[model samples]
Target: MRVPVLNPNYLLTSVLFVLFGSFDCSELDMDGEISLRLEHSLDMGKSWQDRGSLSFSKARSAIPTVNQGPLSDENLSTLENLCSKNMFYLIKVTGDGIGELQSYTPACTMLDSSLAEQITLFLDWRGNPVAANLASRIGVVGHKVTAGKFDTRVQIQSMENGPTPDTAAYIQKMEEEKSRKMSGEKPDNRSFFAKYWMYIVPLCFILLINSAGAPENGGR
Candidate 1:
């Protein structure tokens, strides 16, 4: 009786598939001592008026949905003043004993008496807010909130996708370029010597100098 021998290539591929599939992207500690607050500053961050509060817990899912409190009269008045001056509306997020402020002169908010109600908090994979204070963690960011008229609702959401490069298009482009080159495409029509004349000239000059300095008959 002969025992079936597993192909090494097949075994390696199976192992890799299992390892990659088992890899969980949500590795951050959701139970960390962190809190979020939606605040605004009319005086360019000189002060902050808290408009809403956000809290996270371990009992809930890894990512929690935050429903912001309605905007007050002061908030509306501040927005109006900033819109009149054509200045930016400043927003500050405080978490883990640190504060992060962002400023944007949104045209939507300026043109109409509108405010971006929905706020999404992009957190690092390690369950920390993707902030400058904590720069070591990896996360996906660049979220912008556009305003809706007579609305001031805010929500904080966790980062769904980690820092995964979407390089399929780039890889496809490279493969096409490679295939084109393999198909005898002469994108650079210049000869090798023509393309590398500077290097070749320097090398040839060095060889000539060496030959001139060398004694005749192999320095005998």
Candidate 2:
């Protein structure tokens, strides 16, 4: 009996599939507080205003509150002084009211005419807000930029810290597609001669031509 020959590439692919399947692939359940506040200096760091805070966590998400009023004289004075120095005004972000506060220095001058009216907040995988412009030790950590005013926007976004891919769903979809393709396939019902007619017909034609052209069988 003739044995079926196995393909080397197919064997390698099967081995890789088995190896990956054997590994335990599970998602980690990580959570934390994502409280953030912006402290702005209106008197060139002499004094500051602690803006209303925003929260972004699995438990609850928040939006920034409107400033009670426009920038006070003190705030405007601070911004003008910093602008004269060609320095950007500093924004202090307190994360969960713990650890070192992160700083956000907008390139815009603190003056209302120059200040960018919008800012975005980004969250890490642990649900903590990080500096949007600073380089993260853990790499990019934002999913999307939350759009809000420079002072009141507390939009939350995840970077690389977003959720892991849903492998289970992806695998299920692949399996369904594979099964569908298998079930949709039609069986080969042609006779052997019909399946190999091209090769058989060519060889038969060559054999007939050779036979007709050859000298008649030699006398016995």
- Candidate 1: lDDT over CA atoms? 0.46
**Compared with the true structure, what per-residue lDDT tens digits does model 1 show for residues 17-44?**
4433433434445555456775656665
Alpha-carbon RMSD to native, per candidate? 21.0, 23.7
* lDDT minimum window of 10 residues, candidate 2: 211-220
Q: Give per-model TM-scores.
A: 0.41, 0.42
TM-score, model 1 to reference: 0.41
Q: Scored by CA lDDT, what does every candidate get?
A: 0.46, 0.44
Candidate 2's residue-wise lDDT over 1-220, tens digit each?
9999985434533544553343323113234445555565544455657855555544334443434234555555555666677766555556543443444353233343233333455543334444443211222232221222233334445434222233445446446655776999664566746644544454455435423421211100
lDDT of 2: 0.44
